[model samples]
Target: MPVPVPRQRDIPATDSGPAPQASLTLLVVEDDPAGGLTVPEILDADGHRIRIRSARNLTEATRLLTPDVHCVLLDLDLPGPGPGEDGLGALREVLRIAPRHAVLVLTGEADADRAAEAVRVGAQDFLYRDELDGRLLSRAIRYAVERKRADIAQYKLAESKLRAQENARLERGLLPTPLLEGSDLRFAARYRPGRSRALLGGDFYDTVRTPDGTVHAMIGDVCGHGPDEAALGVELRIAWRALTLAGLCGDDLLATLQEVLEVERPCEEIFATLCTVDISPDGRRAGLCLAGHPAPLISRPGGPARLLPYDDSGPALGLLPRARWPRRQVDLGGSWSLMLYTDGLIEGRIGEGRERLGQDGMVEMINRHLERGLSGEALLEASVTEARRLNGGELTDDVAVVLLSRAAGRTPAA
Candidate 1:
């Protein structure tokens, strides 16, 4: 008897009975003008009748293939299509058309060599036409379907791992390596991107000692948290470093950076908050400039920690056409530590409330860490850790912090 076929046409709704449970579908591609090839009544693993659809040629098979069809049975002797003179041509065509579906090849006992070749070419399995029966075909179809699913899953996992490795290499290249070769100041920085599995974000910073024995340090945050913003931040950082090395400082350096921002930013509405500090050769005096950024905190040996002057800060970059940022000079005592940070450090929510750990809370947290004798990397690590603890989880924004310290009786290395 010929295999039972399911209805391919849509049936009008009737209140007489509920819709039938969905069953597994199989497509059979073969050329049997004499109607000799026959498929017995096959039942799936769940005991439901497996619906069959017959296609006489490649064209018919292509038209019959649908998303709901889980498996395909191709006859190796059914000629036409593909390069091989052997009857495996039809098998190859079926495989190409149903890449995501399980496939089985049917062949006579004499053509065992071609059947094995078919498996190597991507068919799930092969069956002898003489041994074809309901029980055997059911088990083979089930195994082929599961094998195809496992193959696809393995491919996706490998692709994900390769992508992660590439991203890690790229991010490491983009991060800054401080150029403090001839400087006596001890530098420490901590960075954490808000995005999951990301090493870098829109926040960027850099420290470089110029030929004039001055150390130029900067920290800035782009307006958004996306790859475009991250790219813009990197461009701004590279430009800042190049300008500083070229003897640009104070308002001139920032003005040129603004120009780069205007040109590189993905949109006109985007802006960046930045803080720049240029330390004199002797390390006892410095010039500070803020462009709508948070003021840096200074801690001295004999006094409390406090924020630098931000009253003279100007508008953020890309905000105005002719904006001017005034550089304020501040005196550094014999021994002190300066901390520069982005807003992400202080903007995390406290507990489950809407209140944030603003600058005031950050100052209090830092003072406590200072009392505990945490300095350099340890200090920065503790501060960030405590902020995360207070917020009850990871901060939803990128955080970048830089610390520059000058010790008494310490001088630049020759």
Candidate 2:
């Protein structure tokens, strides 16, 4: 049976202060022929009388061990272990039953070895019954609780670090690496996820130069913000790469991607916006395809940045069946730069207002950066960093930006 300890409201409050302390219920397991064990009234750090529940044996202890119990104090003197049996068998059982609670063990002075052994096993602390006092017991209880809390906190920290490392490895594999080994175009990209503590989002980009001397680059946004969308984006990027390597282009390539998106998406409402460009071998002309996506920005050495024509763009992938994305031809001149990006870049609010840094705003920002002699990787970093700055803080969407450039003296034919 369980017995409650008498409350002592008259005890002088300890230095730990007068703040109302949350009372901790301590379960005491002991066996005495005198019916119930007598424990000195103990007060917690905050001067509140510590509540106590006494269990005559392990059976009662187990029955009384509930989530509300904060600590367990076991008496190692309980009889049961035979000659060859472990002396701490009762303590071990208590630990197994209340693994999450702080524990203390009580033993006689002569059985000091057993007390030490009890602490080694799992008990937070052990006390010789002869040395038991209200003050000592109070401090021990407080110490044990704090130690257990620290242990649990350390374990959680280690677990979170392990999860982060695993996520980094997975993200490295999921994000595509540009394949521009023999191509003259200089490639650079930047990506950021809107999710707090996340490394990747639904935005993705890839650039590859095929054997036919045509460089294909793409950027897309899976219309949502999470791992599911990020996963879908990876799948689409890989599919596009494979189909491009196999010589598919324009509407044919997009049609196949739409089919893949429709079949693989989590639901029918899920869709993706995409912008793809196939630059010619001479870097003088290119094919542009926009699947309900923002047009790519183009900039030449002496001209202002502008958006490619989006008049013939088709509906976003997965939005309609048999949708045709007309591949429009655009002249890239000899020396030019193309920037393909997800909507996250332009969707951020400008100057803390309801107004967004739309395509026009983005174009103006890029031209400003270009005027300052920024190009390639420097240009991309500056552009994205500025967008985040203008938004007043981090943008709450996944952003991906890719830059492919042809220098004035460095042509593909050269």
Candidate 3:
């Protein structure tokens, strides 16, 4: 609560307002009274007295720290535990007990380098023994406290920016790409971030083609959201791709992924839901795997859109080490469409009172789009946008949708 001194040339022309009442208590730490800590008179910038409390050692400094102490002035000449623990040790312990207290160090005239080191380790700044005067010292104490607070704020802002950048990179890495070279089928997908943009928490999807002409695609969700969980989702997606390229599919692929979750997850009680589709070469049948995940919706010409059968599906990944993922094959007509999506798209409440637009609601919504003649990218965009609108502003959960369509009448190859 010490008074703030104006900068070098900013002295007020209208008589600086009444000095702030002197409530700040400073603790002076020095080993020997005869050696140093012998400032003749310490006073505020406007001549108000500064209550001084002196400590002869670290032990005494610990006792001198109290609620009223705003700052600690330490002696750098004190004995050390090592390069990291000389004056820094005492400064850290002081803060451990009083985290908000500002710290300043007193150093020998030639110990400028060590003084800088102390500041780097968390001290506000340092003052040479012989250069301390009442006004200059008071100003230093006031400015040091403000600088420390600003430093913490800047550090948080920088940490946030770095996390955002990392999330962006991770997002690009986890989502899948279409590998259908020289095919008429157009691939369209979209992802919307939830309330927290830490990463793709609520939704995830991936696609990769195997040595055979088959294309594998998946979209899933990890229950309960945050950056850590989102990161886990990304890890699972990458593992799935690597395993697919390595020839692991169906049950074997998911079992190994569950092992990864058991080892890498930050804690227990976390689980993930997944939906996967493997399209046949002739595009007439799709093998679907539902691991405690929502089933995909199928849209076909002259047929009502409906949820793909998901009976006897396995539990979500990470819940059990040996859980089985039952793969079911469904035959598609000549021309067909399959949409795999995370639950975030449906959990959105349409009009309050705990009413969620469940699986049936989603199927009906898609049929509405069908009536409007919307398809491909336009259809996916409209569906996601409407979901958000129903939820009233962002859905508050990550949403990802992947659609794979098999065009009609391929002329019955050969």
Task: Specify the highest-lDDT model's number.
Answer: 1
Model 3: per-residue lDDT, tens digit, 61-138? 788787778788777766543465676676666657666778888877798888888888788888887676667777
lDDT by candidate, in order shown: 0.86, 0.85, 0.77
TM-scores of the models, in the order given: 0.81, 0.81, 0.75
Q: Candidate 1's residue-wise lDDT over 1-414, tens digit each?
A: 123222233323342133236457888888776553445446666655666788887888899999889999888878858554545777777888888999988888998998999999999999888777777888898999999999989988999889878767656645789999999999999999988877679998999999889999999999988888888888898899999999999899889999999999989999999999999988999999999999999999867789988999999999998899999999997799999999999999899999999999999999999988889999999999999999999999999999999998997777
Question: Runs in model 1 with CA error above 4 Å?
Answer: 1-70, 75-100, 105-143
RMSD of 2: 4.7
What is the per-residue lDDT of model 2 for residues 1-414, given as tens digits with 9 covering 90 to 100? 222334344555464344434877788888865676656558787666677788887888889999888889888866533554443988888888888899998877899888888989989999777677777788888999888888789889999999889768757745778888777889888888889999888887888889988999988899998788878988998999999999999999999999999989998999999998999887889999999999999898778999888999999999989999999999998788889998899999999679999999999999999899998889989998999999999999998899888876674433
Worst 10 residues of 2 by lDDT: 1-10
lDDT of 2: 0.85
Among residues 3 or more apart in sequence or in different chains, the pairs in candidate 1 whose N, CA or C atoms overlap within 3 Å are none
